[model samples]
Target: MKTRIQELRKQHKLSQEELALAVGVTRQTITSLEVEKYTASLVLAYKIAKYFDLTIEDVFDFSELEEI
Candidate 1:
């Protein structure tokens, strides 16, 4: 899935480490997520959304992928 994580982080003036710390993940995790090499769990997603003061739908979208 593609995400606007980098853009959002820049908007907030946050480094990858800062975002990871805020969302309770490692810097590598944030890097992986930004590069689409990892997918976040629902709990992680919620934490990220909460940190950004956004709803999950606002931060993430899965419509481009088809169901299994």
Candidate 2:
């Protein structure tokens, strides 16, 4: 999955560690999300999006994925 985590984080002037702290995850987890090496679960995605004051679709690009 592709995410706008880095972009949003920069726009918010937040470091990966800060974002992780705000969202209750590890810095490595945030790094993994930024690199698309990890796909977030529904709850995690919700938490991240909410932390950014954005919808999940705003943070994550799901248009390329086929419907399950």
Candidate 3:
């Protein structure tokens, strides 16, 4: 899956650690999410999206795999 995490973080001028703190995760988790190395649990994804005032679909896109 691909995400606009990096772009959003930059737009908000927040460091990975700051975002992680806001979303109740570790900095490494944020790094992993930004690089697409980790798939968040439903709760975690919701927390992140809520922190940004966005919906899960607005932050992460899985439509590319819809055909599969």
Name the regions of candidate 3 deviating beyond 4 angstroms.
none
Give one digit per residue, the lDDT tens place, for model 1 in 1-68: 87778888999999999999998999999999899999889999899888999987788777676564
Winner by lDDT between candidate 3 and candidate 2 = 2
- Pairs of residues at least 3 apart in sequence or in different chains that clash in candidate 2: none
The clash count for each model shown is 0, 0, 0
User: Compared with the true structure, what per-residue lDDT tens digits does model 2 show for residues 1-68?
Assistant: 99999999999999999999998999999999999999999999999999989999999999778665
Query: Cα lDDT of model 2 overall?
Result: 0.95
Worst 10 residues of 2 by lDDT: 59-68
Clashing residue pairs, candidate 1?
A: none
- Tens digits of per-residue lDDT for model 3, 1-68: 88888999999999999999998999999999999999988899899888889999999998987979
lDDT of 3: 0.92
TM-score of each: 0.90, 0.93, 0.93
- Candidate 1 stretches greater than 4 Å from native: 66-68
Model 3 clashing residue pairs (backbone):
none
On the 0 to 100 scale, the lDDT of residue 36 in model 3 is: 94
